[model samples]
Target: MDYDGILNRKPFSTAKDEKKLMYGEWLTELTDYHRKHCHSYGQLLKHLMIPEHSHMGEEEIPMLPVGLFKDMDLISIPGNKVFKTMTSSGTKGQTVSRIYLDRDTANYQQRALANIGGDFWGEERLPLLVLDSPDVLKNRNLFSARGAGILGFSIFSSRICYGLDQDMNLDTERIQQFLDRYTGKRILIFGFTYIIWKYFYQALAKSVQKLDLSEGILIHGGGFKKLEDQSVSAHEFKERIREVSSIKEIHNYYGMAEQTGSIYMECPKGHLHASLYSDIITRRGKDFSVCSHGEKGIIQVLSPLALSYPGHSILTEDEGIILGEDDCPCGRLGKYFKVLGRIHQAEIRGCSDTYDG
Candidate 1:
């Protein structure tokens, strides 16, 4: 199949049946590819007793636990071909998952992100306001999920401005300058949920000053766990942001470094919708059985973009449920769902909790 052709289609245009067939074929091929190149992944397939030449459905595809990346070098590409290595967010002394990418895979990730993001925010590039300090992206070759996300979404920006200083302090002057320059134009704001809540929103709430960002659209995710612990619900998060900035459009996405480009984005209806580049399944923890609609279980993310690593299908530790498919009120033609939270006792990981500033 022409992968580029598939990517060129509108992100949510494909129906579930067609996507299953196409993704099944491509993902099956990827499994064979990884099994041939990565000895560790090959051993895993053998150990699982999956036949080499047998074709499998999307649900039948074998999945590696997301944690395995933290403990093993799971690269399918040659060492010399590694374009960059991305690590999951981790605090001091905590192990982080490392994802290896070659040039081809990296390019695909960027293209996929473009296609998906365009569907949400439109194809026009807007000025981007990053909510984190610029220091996070200093290490170009090796960086955490926060840096990777900033770089990935930077593609949609006409120009970029960091909202925070090197010390992780919210640079109100810089942000005010950016808003003044882009006045009356629609702008894009990107950040982790916790950072925006703790640094951006709270800082503005305490100060007597308020900035008008009515034309700004904020996209945040990756730290709902911390917010949940603080008793901040999604409604409260958005309400607080509006109280300070009056920015009406707010979206929360769900994704991780393991499947960087295949993010599930939240629609206006407040459900995370899976795109053509990716799919989500909820599975029962005890026996790994597929869950019915509205049934909560572990999240199994499937993506064909992880060619440089055997990360195409991963059983994540997060819990969620499928709301419906091909019938979202948001008008997208794919599965839309909600993430309840991480599995109980699951280690704290992801960009939102890794902030030390």
Candidate 2:
């Protein structure tokens, strides 16, 4: 299906009613497409008794549990057509989720991400300073979430520099050179949350050197389980980052490997804003019923970008609460929410914290 109509729309421009109509048609089509192409998914729909061509509201759509990808090869495309396989980060001996992407789906992901990032960072491509080592991308065929994140966001950068060495140590000299080269210019910095806190922020805190990134915008995601253990709140993370570098703007996004590009980015108001490409709904654990605004429940992420797999609507292990819709003080039009971390005792599978590399 052609996605130009939806992709062309401004990231957060569509209001709730219009977005519901637009996304409803596209997502319903995607549901039928996946049910026909993927045998396992077809059986799942059959078992759930959701008839073919059924037009259901966003919350009424069937959501495959996110963990299913860890146990099954849930690709809708033929094997030969697979362009890339993305794996979620996990500790040693833990099974990771595998997300298959065909060329078209992958392209859509890139385009969608570019559109969303453009809305926030502007159209100009700036110099990018990645917080991880370049070696993480050595295995191009299969990517961990961290690797894919770096590659995906690299589109916003005119020149890219790796701030960490091969051993995951902060390469201060390399970072300094990168800063010097882009002095007095706005640059982009990307990294996983825990990695930035442990390697970049803490490492810088130990040294007498203080780098200047007053003109930089930092985008970070991947769960905060580790930092939470250290009692590091989001506010603290931003304040500490300022102590290390003069970077002023920091955004904490929420996304998973299952649905990569259509991330929920945090607005200036500290709420995670869902873009036009995706939507968010919270469900009570006891019955999976939709939750009202300000009520915390399991987060169900809905996106139409996962054409290569049955991942369009997924019941994530994470918990969150819908703060508001179409009325954020930031003026973005869409549902804004706050992630309340993973469900109790859910496997610790955030990109940075789980990645042993």
Candidate 2 residues 203-280, lDDT tens each? 999999999999999999987888989999999999999989989999999888899899988888898999998999
Per-model TM-score on C-alpha atoms = 0.98, 0.98
lDDT of 1 by residue, 1-357 (tens): 476886778999998899999878988998999999999999999999999978989999999999999999999988999999999877778999999999888988889989989999999999999999898888899968888899999999999999888888888999999999998999999999988988899899999989898999999978577788889999999999999999999999999899998988999999999999999989999999999999999999999999999999999988999999999999999999999887996887646536765
Clashes of each: 0, 0
lDDT (Cα atoms) of all candidates against the true structure: 0.90, 0.90
**CA shift of 286, model 1, Å:** 1.3
User: Candidate 1, which segments miss by more than 4 Å at Cα?
Assistant: none
Colliding residue pairs in candidate 2: none
After aligning candidate 1 to the native by TM-score, how far in Å is the CA of 249 from where it should be?
A: 0.3
